[model samples]
Target: MIGLVLAAGAGRRLRPHTDTLPKALVPVDGDLSVLDLTLRNFSEIGLTEAAVVVGYRKEAVYARKDELQAAYGLKLTLIDNDRAEEWNNAYSLWCARDVLKQGAVLANGDTVHPVSVERTLLDSRGGGRRIILALDTAKRLADEEMKVIAADGRGVRQITKLMDPAAATGEYIGVTLIEPEAAEALADALKATFERDPDLYYEDGYQELVDRGFRIDVAPIGDVPWVEIDNHDDLARGREIACLY
Candidate 1:
């Protein structure tokens, strides 16, 4: 039951700031970076072993690994994603494939969500195929966010990333509670997507598995404190969320 933090994105939208530091190292509310906050939140839920995948400005992510290890008694592992500049979050997951076991919680390096995210994953009992955090995109309709089209009746059917605005349904909050077998299945598809088009995102893997009839449980974090810090606006949003700091 280890936690994996996917932080290998180039974060081009973050520009000069990202040029100097990884998004996980980006300061959230002075003295605390988003990565630190995320780990602290993990600690609250009793997750002390967190593996962070680093890419853009990888050194910055490594610098925190030691601090996090000493300060929290958490064993932080930094996996250098050599191809991070050429791949997507899915690729980052692929790099950590050797580490993630069954019943693991995976979050993005830039995701700043409530402490409850940890509780949600830990307490779920792993009864379903995959449990993921969903959010209402109705409020903020048009970001390049991964949106899911979830069908309410019978069971949940999620269609993620509608290129057309009218087709998108809900937003994916980048928090995942996954079964190792399912992850391996998804990773296989992801490898194909990356091999064909290395630049494509990991969501493409979901599209493949969903086509094969995999049903993922939707844990809607509707109106809860969650922010994916891809740019300046998100950083501001992170600042606004009630921090445990």
Candidate 2:
């Protein structure tokens, strides 16, 4: 399996920092960007090749592609998402459909988490599971967070940000393991998700999968130190915890 990163979105809330670089390039540790951490985590987990979906100042990534590859000791494949500025991540993810077909450990480029999160997903693989998401059962959920409702054996029944926080079992920590068998269907689901509403998140695509009777397993990353960097506050929080990772 290869590592997949969805790093196409333009974080408008992040302004000047994102004006030239994508959100993934925003540094959390001294000189290590969020993407750097992601690649490092992938490397640590034995995934020596990765595909990154890039847009919204994609040139910045192109400029640093070789440097990032050399630093991470991995091969980098940059996928282009032309509509990143106009659409949501459902499309960004779909852009890497071919790569996903090979199976992948997918991490949102803006998330800063330790290698443990990836390890948890990897450890939970098999037993006929096609898709496994890293769910954080410990974090207190808010309406803004992408919430999930999953049962022990039944797997995830619902995954969305619009759901009531009180009803959610956990928050999806922006990491997933996709088995090769599930990729085609997932790609189709993602296509339908974005075509229906360009503003919908890739999580919505997972919802689509559930709606179609796909069993998406959830692996709880117990009490992990992680942050999804959205705005400046998240970036600050990321910095505090990134060093710990």
Give Cα-based local distance difference scores for all models: 0.71, 0.94
lDDT of 2 at 56: 90
Clashes of each: 0, 0
Error of 1 at 120 (Å): 2.3
Alpha-carbon shift of residue 87 in model 1 (angstroms): 1.7
Q: Write the per-residue lDDT of candidate 2 for residues 1-245, one digit (tens) a residue.
A: 99999988898888888888899998899999999999999999998899999999899999999999999999999999999999999999999999988999999999999999999999999899999999999999998999999998999999998899999999999999999999999999999999999999999999999999999999999997999999999999999999997
RMSD of each: 2.4, 0.7
Candidate 2 off by > 4 Å: none
Residue 46 in model 1: lDDT:
84
Candidate 2's displacement at residue 90, Å, is 0.5
